[model samples]
Target: MSLSFTSPNKTIFIYDSTKTSEVALLQHVKDQTSKLTEVPINITSVTPQLLNSILTRMEPGTSSLLINKTSPWYRCFCEDFSEMNDFILKKTFVKFPSLIQTPIVIHQDEVYVNPSMKHIFDIYEEIYV
Candidate 1:
């Protein structure tokens, strides 16, 4: 399945909850992406296609960084599973999208999984300027 954009805007944000410690940062990214792109950012939960796109396009390190290792969901998976790879993880995400991390930002051809403000800002500047 292919990921479809609801809007013509080129950015997509896969965020979990607003209650996270990164709420402020996520808001900042939303505001900036909106202002700079002149279109609302596409905020969504992790859908199957979205997860597939992320698994295929994003680097393994960045994708792994987004996972909440301490979450009960993850802990349980780790307890039962010994070997882990991108393929297995992708399947897991397909089943439990909520278990995946949040604030996954995607722009034109760039995918930032749980990135820092500096990284987002850099991309924004490069694209908008």
Candidate 2:
């Protein structure tokens, strides 16, 4: 049950709505994508399938990039997991979505994790403008 983007022009925004920063970023993405008449953006929460898709796109040894280091679950149990592999991290993220980073934007083959406004602008220009 992996997530796939069939349309090359489409953008996918995976985020945690509970986080204020992510919510703000989502609004910014919405504002930017709205200007594009054709390219559509899919905004969604981080599901297991979506998370796996994101993990696959990310570079090796960077699997923990999506984990929220500030999360309580992470702080409490992070040390316990001496062997924190992708599978364990995925399970942990599934159990605690709040423990995963927010506002990951996927545009074509590129996956932006917690992207800044500048990154969004660059993506817009590259894809739309």
Candidate 3:
């Protein structure tokens, strides 16, 4: 028997809850993808403020994580992003190098981005699927 996650039926769209514009874009992407592929998706616009709450909702080892840093204005996100990454790393015991403004895969669960969303989704699809 193989171990696995009991994934939720809805596809969650996690994002930096503080960024309203990004959230809107994420919703747009979800809408476009759903219409194109007929996938049942649910948008989960989350932020670091709800970090713990968000983590608690995920099924163990069932995350399709991505960290994107495509904007020049990222000093803001890094603060909360770093804190959130640290929290997850401690919980999962995965390690990543320090961020000098680059996106990375933290704890093998989350992605730390420094600017790569276009190809990142393709990467996410490759890994998760």
**Per-residue lDDT of 3-122 in model 2, one digit per residue for the tens?**
574455767666666667767776766775643212111223446786778787787877667767777777776785558877887777777776776567777667777788787877
Q: What is candidate 3's lDDT per residue for 7-55, written digit by digit as tens? A: 3332334334345654554565555444221111113222333334334
Worst 10 residues of 1 by lDDT: 35-44
Query: Cα lDDT of model 1 overall?
Result: 0.59
What's the candidate order when arranged by decreasing TM-score?
2, 1, 3
Candidate numbers, best lDDT first, in rank order: 2, 1, 3
lDDT of 2 at 57: 75
Per-residue C-alpha lDDT of model 1 across residues 40-68, encoded as one tens digit per residue: 11244445575666566666555565566
Top candidate by TM-score: 2
What TM-score does candidate 1 get on C-alpha atoms?
A: 0.67
Query: How much is the lDDT of residue 94 in candidate 1?
Result: 66
Two-way lDDT contest, 1 vs 3, winner:
1
Error of 1 at 59 (Å): 3.4
Clashes of each: 0, 0, 7
